[model samples]
Target: MIIDRIDRALDMTSAIVAGIDGGQYADASLCAGWTVRDELNHLVGGMRIFTARLTGTDPGGEHHDDWLGDEPANAFHLAAEADRAAWRRPDALEGVIELGFGAVPAPAAAAIHHTEVLVHGIDLALVTGQEKLVDDQECERLLGEMRAMDFSMFRNPGMFGPETAVADDAPGHRRLLAFLGRAV
Candidate 1:
């Protein structure tokens, strides 16, 4: 079920990336101080890193490397394909992954990966006027899961900020973004 959610998130992000125009890449994203291109590169690099960790292969670059190159959309697609394949492996969720923070169980790592991809995708979509592309049900599900966990550890600079208030009647994606400290 988690992997299925991840696949859906990847597909949604891929669509958002494909819709991005060259001129819009430099626009500011919901992530403070990060442009659209910066966010996209980070997303793609994260995918590669997760895939490498799952398959025991070289990630081929650092987290902040310029992975997008001349074709940002194409780069994202390639990374997504590899990431999906690695996550689909029969034994992928059987062990722990050595993340920069520490060794996290595979299921936890997958949840974090899903959050990264989905949140960043929403960030991009919001900035690019494509908010309609976000999956509200997935956002609601993730928001509930986050609320059930102790997510405060991730609330720091460059990660999630303190939770912001949003109207209860707001859309699911907007509520999730607000909970993650984005001013939605």
Candidate 2:
């Protein structure tokens, strides 16, 4: 059910992307430093990285920051555009393999991909003045992961003092983003 909501959200996001008007792609976004196109691309590119890793073809994880070589925003925009197109490919749905991450199977990569698509789609919509809605289930799953993950992973260090306490019962999606310092 959660995955279904995510998949639906991704599909809606793709539709929104397809309708973007001329040069609207270059407009600035709420991401502070990134544009809508850049955010979409970044969102999709991050998924591809997970795809590669789950396939065991990502290389012993030795490359700590594979995306380090490219502009983070551009990396996402360019990669996401390609990936968005790739999702249209017939083989896209056939992907499934396990590189292992605790109980998370390779298909969990699909979940992660869905999460990025939906959550970042909201970001894109917010910046582009588009309509974006997240299903309750999808929000729950994302909020769960956001809580489980340190979230500081996306932020600069020392931003949250060790004494800070995140209330578990806080609204899930907001909790996730806020913990990452993006909810504000």
Candidate 3:
């Protein structure tokens, strides 16, 4: 189910975050103008925001706030734990979630959260030489889901870019990244 997918994504992302070297945090990531630290901070913030929305609590900060103050991995772990718990709540997926953009059905929000966690995990893995940690099955699954949806609305400079071309024989992760406009 969706919660299981979210859990797997969160676990993978937490592993990637745990393996990041201190010095590599400043390195550039596939996301334009975002360093590894920036991407991680955003991921952590997203987790916190989603959790807050799910539990009806204040997130206490903005999306771009400095979430990775001293120990980035610890921050990610804490947020991921909270996010996982929130998603697992008995009635978590029974209603609409109010987001910054608008209200989204709970299932849709879970899928979006799963995609964000997995994709950002891949982004960190690729840049930090931890590609082996990526789950190809998850990528393929999300890619298929995205293909069936109207993803064009999210195709923009700050979100997903125009789909980039990739060899048909590329690995699932690479193909998924290419589909999301990452130069994989």
Highest lDDT, which number?
A: 3
Model 1 misplaced regions, further than 4 Å: 156-158
Global lDDT of model 3: 0.93
lDDT of 2 by residue, 1-184 (tens): 4445545766666655555564666788645676766665565556565545443345323323354243444444454555555444444445464423333443455665676677666666555566444344556666676667765543445433222335767555445445444533
Candidate 1 minimal-lDDT segment of 10 residues: 151-160
lDDT of each: 0.92, 0.53, 0.93
Instruction: Quote the positional error of residue 6 for candidate 1 in Å.
Output: 0.4
Q: What is the C-alpha RMSD of each candidate to the true structure, in Å?
A: 1.2, 7.4, 1.2
- Report the CA-based lDDT of candidate 2 relative to the real structure: 0.53
The Cα RMSD in angstroms, rounded to one decimal, for candidate 3 relative to the true structure is: 1.2
Off by over 4 Å in 2: 1-6, 47-108, 148-176
After best superposition, candidate 2 residue 1: deviation in angstroms? 5.8
In candidate 1, list every pair of residues with a backbone clash.
Answer: none
Winner by lDDT between candidate 2 and candidate 1: 1
Q: Quote the positional error of residue 14 for candidate 3 in Å.
A: 1.0
